[model samples]
Target: MAKTRTDLINQVLDRLNILVYGQSPSLEDVQRADRIVDGAIAKLASLDIYYVQDPGQAGPSGGAIEDEAFLPLADYIASFHLLADARTQALAQIAEAELRTIAAPARTLRTLRVDPALTPRRYGYYRGGI
Candidate 1:
């Protein structure tokens, strides 16, 4: 199951302690948090660094669980070590840097492979040059 927007918002709120432990969030707060999550996702998407499934579709509460492609990326982003190391930094800042770090290399590689002008020289000759 793919993780939904609500799940992400709850995680963020929980981390911030806005929603206390064992206490459910009110409807208004949930709505507000949902918007925040949307904004964060939009910001990340604009950079093409965050990938997830069914981003806009509605699902059960806390949204749907995350899919395989998204899970690993999410885990890395939410990892305790990285969070602890950047304790003083805002979550958005850390997330942006981390997402960029994970995506920039792949973007570069893709550009290199797709752009003939940027591609590296190859030595071996093939039977059918065409």
Candidate 2:
């Protein structure tokens, strides 16, 4: 089953220890987390490493990323946004590193060609037999 935005927000809140068992987060906090998740998605889209689709709608009830691997990335980013402490920052960094490993950038191979006419022969050798 695909996870929803609420799941992502809850995961982030859990990571930040903002939402504990038997307690629900406030509506304002939930909205804040939703925005944070959107920002995280935007950040990933900006990297161009992955193709992220629009969340379609806005709010915690909106759709979520299908890629399970990217879920943690969103969680870490949202957690950092909720709590920009050194630890959260480090976790975010680690998440990014893991993302790079999961989806390494594509490398294009390039070829170099040299035209004989453009190439210079020996120092004393002339092109026109001069």
Candidate 3:
């Protein structure tokens, strides 16, 4: 998983075959590639991840979390998937599902995940003795 913007950019570029290992990129190619990466990152930054980010920053304000790194991985992967399909101008069903998951993750491990504070009690069911 990518921990930084540079890492994320490199991974996407590699996936797109825009850059290959054992070869240096030309300045023009680098600039063009970086533009695409920046576009994807900007799209990703619009997600509702639990992080403090500056007005203009593309990532967390205080930097990304190391222990809970899956958040960033999901963001980068979703962004890359979007970029790869830019020509289509529409995301695949799988990409849409991934983006949805990133935006609102489900708590499916438990059979019932509800907020006790928000749950209303039935007054009729209450009793003074057991």
TM-score of each: 0.52, 0.66, 0.43
lDDT winner between candidates 2 and 3: 2
Give, for candidate 1, the lowest lDDT window spanning 10 residues. 75-84
Each candidate's root-mean-square deviation in Å? 10.1, 8.8, 9.1
TM-score of 3: 0.43
Q: Which residue pairs does candidate 1 place in steric collision?
A: 1-65, 2-64, 2-65, 2-66, 3-64, 3-65, 3-66, 4-64, 7-62
Residue 25 Cα positional deviation in candidate 1, in Å, after optimal superposition? 0.9
How big is the positional error of residue 55 in model 2, measured in Å on the Cα after superposition?
Answer: 3.5
Cα deviation of 50, candidate 3, in Å: 10
Best candidate, lDDT-wise?
2
Q: Which stretches of candidate 3 lie over 4 Å from their true place?
A: 45-93, 108-130
Which sections of candidate 2 miss by over 4 Å?
54-56, 79-82, 105-130
Give the per-residue lDDT of model 3 (tens digit) for 1-130. Answer: 2155444444445555567797665656545555554454455566543332322234312233232433344334434443555532233334445545555766868787799999998678556786
In the range 1-130, model 2's lDDT, one tens digit per residue, is 5666676677777777787797888898878777776667776778864544545355666664566555556645654463667777777777776676667655667677889899888577456953
* lDDT (Cα) of model 2: 0.67
Write down the worst ten-residue block by lDDT for model 2. Answer: 49-58
